[model samples]
Target: MSVLRLVLGDQLSDDLSALKDLNPDVDTVLMAEVRDEATYVRHHQQKLALVFAAMRNHAERLKGRGVNVRYVRIDDADNSGSITGELARALDDGAHEAVVMTECGEWRLAEHLAAFAEGAGLPVEIREDRRFISSHDRFRRWASGKSQLRMEFFYREMRRETGILMDGDQPEGGRWNYDAENRKKLAKGVTPPDRLLIPPNAVAREAMGDVERLFGDHFGSLDGFGWATTAEEAEASLKHFLKDVLPSFGDWQDAMAEGQPWMWHGLISTSINLGLLDPLDVCKRAEAVYRAGKAPLNAVEGFIRQILGWREFVRGIYWLKAPEYRARNFLDADRKLPWFYWSGETDMACVADVVKTTRDNAYAHHIQRLMVTGNLALLLGVHPDQVDDWYMCVYADAYEWVEMPNTRGMALFADGGIVGSKPYAASGAYIDRMSDYCGACRYDVKSKSGDAACPFNRLYWGFLERNRGRLRDNVRLAMPYRTLEKFGEAKRKALAAEAEACRTLLGAAPME
Candidate 1:
């Protein structure tokens, strides 16, 4: 039978299941750059360029190997502007008897494709995407009866199942996690090594131009665009991280510095999510460094956990409880996202820096993402819909499968306690301890009540006080609740007032 195999932009791996039993003569690999997917969120300009460039490069590679690839450019004259429309266009020729594709990454797209498959002229087979450590069935089995789907416990299962960092049923170094060892702040005068920027090739430059012509009003800049656009370039970038950056990654994985956005990070998430780099292969490579004594256990283990544990765990949660999970708002945070999130026009140095980096590089390290942007949004009680849309629109590595759980569950705690036991809510002290931004900020990090005090401090207390009915019973937040209880009712009320004032300063007010 002649099969038309569909390859989504993110599914660029050569060994993708949809192409497992390909026939070069009769089977065609269908790849399209659809407008529906690109404009779904007004994504970062660089993100659009990166995916299209990577897709084009992967298509070329397949063609080089004599594979029949039916490629569709975003600007094609007869482009249908949607994936389902493109599929219908392809089937009009009656050139194939069956359609095969790996399941998609996002629920939005998955639902669209499922509905299309029900009435398509030919049989459709949506095969499992084998790129992840956990399948839908595997995650369902693990989360079957559990009351709380903690990532730590889920990570342990992945470690044992993959035998990564394992020494015959025991974790290497007699520990399953090195998170405590990985929280050191960046020491003064200890400059982070420079990140390697891969120049855009002709193919990438063309994709970048197309995104600009089509999406000039998108969220981010196209200048200084240096993401690797092919599997070969991605592998080179990974090797650079393993050799030069991985050694110091552990000590300052959570650290932030002024004027330094790429703080000892791997910078490979875009590649991994794009299927240019395999997650398991990347984890094993980091593990190999520990075995060879080239990198420390803390660094290797910390990095591996991000991919094998946290990355996989979030994907599972996204699929396991999505469509409804997207609307969850445990705190009923209804305020609009502050304007500075896009403009980097805030006096708060940490937020401005993170927004600037996100605008310029289409990237930021985890600390910048979590404690700075995400934390502030949580404290501000911005609606999950607004926060979720901003994240999906801004980051290059973001897709709904990975980004939603990280934003709603881990960052915002909108899912209550599904992905985390407690809200990651924190005061200015956490940022001051981890970053250099507070030193130059207009507001004092130490002051609590006055306008001169950092907004995060007041907002931190206010977030807890406002959500006390929901969060006070949480075991992890007991100490904070105890401290708040000692603050007297008057002090608690004052904290909430100050937080509202700060919100006004940031150009947002309490939701009506």
Candidate 2:
């Protein structure tokens, strides 16, 4: 009897530890392109294409290694288009046990796997995913007895664990984080380093065409589809980033420009999430670059912190609070996400540009995610479901485990102060300071009221007013709450009215 081991689209590496002891003659690898996975939330057409193409490439690679791979394509006649259905069919083909690497994201999928395996009357073992340096249990141990989980503390612990950028017992440059030195607005008259854009190969070109035909009605465009769909190409993209853009990555990591969507960003999140590149290796390589004087300490540390700290922290939070975590709506927001998130049609130039870039390429740097789309949604009181779905649908790197915490907790503030101490909700002034898109916009960035005021500014004050009781006790929000206190009743009412008018005017326009 042979063992049937399930491998998801994201679990693509040949180095997967779960495959170590497997007897090739007696082990079968099951990889599938299920319609349910693709259409679960009406994902962007490009996102669907990227995952499917990557899965096909990975399956072929495994088969080339003499692994028995039961690959199921979406167009296959007998395809069940569901993980359980596919797993059951595979099990019926004389498999005694199932082995799998733990899923990367989503409690829903994990629960489904557990239930399905139990019903199959077969032993199922989910081995630890060794791709990440930090384990869920290690994070839990570190978080124990701590009232608040901060990324900085968790990051330092990971540095000590991995010995990355450590100079014996002390950290390199004698500092833990150099974030303050990293935030400089883009200098004028300087051309950005050329980004590494992978021209789609044969597989991607075919997948792109298929996606356009099958998912024509899906939100977002496929004009700028240049992502690497194979491990070799993903590695090339990583090397290019480490060589060219990494030297300036820290300084401009937060900066946004008018037409530039990929700033100092490596644009490797999708590849990393899909198991094409190991996060530990990426961090190690960046640290090596810093030691060689090819990249600055600030740039290396900032980038590593994202992978070691934020990325690991969010995964822990997802596993710890999931199933229930997705339903949290601290603000009780119910407004539908405006349609602009899909259509990229908006009067606000910043919003339009960000959405347009996201539509064209399922890529937006952290600032664009946090300050532009996410901040506006939070200020306008959009429902967490709408915001989360929009985020999950639009980004290629999105998986429920990572995307949920980022969208609901970090971005939307729907989880209150769990993931963030204070709401990231901000007015248009923040956009003005961060990006060049504000100057060309018709809305007044500084205005807090009236029709000509930016909708973000108007809705920001209204959001604070509406959520005063919910957020007033938060020490971080005290300053904003105090400002709200000074406004007289009539003034407060006027601001709310103006915000309401903007909401009415832009109803469904923000989520297009």
Candidate 3:
């Protein structure tokens, strides 16, 4: 029987699992730009455009390869505004006898598609997404007896399994990680290498116009929309990163600079997450660069670890614990997100820079996301749901599988140390050591109290003081708790009061 293969916006690869066994003559590939997915989170305008344009381009490429495709535009006259609605309409039109789709990256959409399949009165098959090196079941077996699921241990096993950087069962250069060497601050007077930016083509322009007409008031701007919208463009981007930026990527991957949003960072996550670039392929290329003496071990290993290790590990944790995982707010953080998160109206130079970069580019490096914005949210005690929603909405690369784990587990420590052993709570001094933002800020990073103090310094102690009962026993946080104890009651109270005033100024509610 002929099949209707459903391809999601992020599942744009030609070798996608659902399309692997496709009989081009009998199967009809179904791609849709549904309002349900786009409006689900008020995604950034550039994010919407990028996905829509990529999907359009992928469908056209499939047609060129002689595969029958049924494409639905968001503004189609008979569009039902949802994935299930569109699928049902397609089924009723009697184009195919069975439905086939690769499992989606999100729980909400996965559940909806599963329900539609059961009710569609047709044969349905949901294939495992084989895009990653680790399968869901394989990851589950590896996690079956572990007390703690740590990415480091999982990464070692992945190295052994793939033999990517393995030297006959041992890691290359006598180490599995080069993270320590990857934390150097940007060198003074040294400029970041320029990155390749793919201008929006006609297809991307139409997609942008659609998003502007539909979601103009969304949280981000589309003025500088230059993300890769096709597999070819994504490949070109990878080549550019390997050649120009990978050498310095390790040295400054954790550093942030004023007005330098793309400082030696690979801008390929959106394309990889969208299936325009293969993760494994990208990792191998980085490895090859190292083999050819083009980049250092720190650069290559760090780059590979992000894709092969963290990326796969997060997907595993998301699938293993999700639905219930989304509600895990171990910190009991209930404060609302600050308004400046969306508006970039804050006087905090570090935060304002990150937010402005997000608004303009729909992107930020991991440190800017984790230390600046995510750290601020965690210290301010923003609710996990609000934090997850904001992160999911603003980044082009964000999907629930990846964003949820990073936000709730790593960033907020909302999962009670499931993803991170400790809350990434830090004083402004950490940022001062890593970036140039402190030099230009109105508040003093050196100050620990009062109105002109960096809010991070005040909130750092306040978070520890407030969560001591829950976090004091954590070994990783022992020193911070001990330091808090040394501060005595008076100093702690003063810090708490200062933090409260800072939160109030930011329009966040005082901790109850």
- What would the TM-scores of all predictions be? 0.99, 0.97, 0.99
Q: List the residue pairs that clash in candidate 1.
A: none
Cα lDDT tens digits for candidate 3, 1-512:
79999999999987899998899989999899999999999999999999999999999999999999999999999999999998888888787899899999999999999899888898999999999889999999999999999999999999898888878989989999999998988889899877799999999999999999988999889999989999999999999999999988888989999899999989999999999999988988998998899999898899899999999999999999988998999989989899999999988999999999999999999999999999999999999999999999999998999999999999999999888889898899999999999999999999988879899997888888889899999999888889989999998888788888887878777445
Q: Which run of 10 residues does model 1 get worst, by summed lDDT?
A: 503-512
Q: Global CA lDDT of candidate 1, please? A: 0.93
Error of 2 at 80 (Å): 0.6
Worst 10 residues of 3 by lDDT: 503-512
Each candidate: what lDDT? 0.93, 0.85, 0.92
lDDT of 3 at 117: 84
Candidates in descending lDDT order: 1, 3, 2
Off by over 4 Å in 3: 510-512
**Which of 2 and 3 is ahead in TM-score?**
3
Error of 1 at 139 (Å): 1.1
Query: Please, what are the lDDT tens digits per residue for candidate 1 over residues 1-512?
Result: 99999999999998999999999999999999999999999999999999999999999999999999999999999999999998998898998999999999999999999999999967999999999989999999999998879889999999999999999999999999999999998897899998888999999999999999999899999997999999999999999999999998999999999889898999999999999999999999999988999999999999999998899999999999988999999989989898899999988999999999999999998988888999999999999889999999999999998999999998999998998888899899999999889999999999986778899997888888889999999999999999999999998998888888887777766666
Please write out the lDDT profile of model 2 over residues 217-330, one tens digit for every residue: 887777778888999999999999999999999999888999988889989999989999989999999999999999999999999999988998898888877778889999
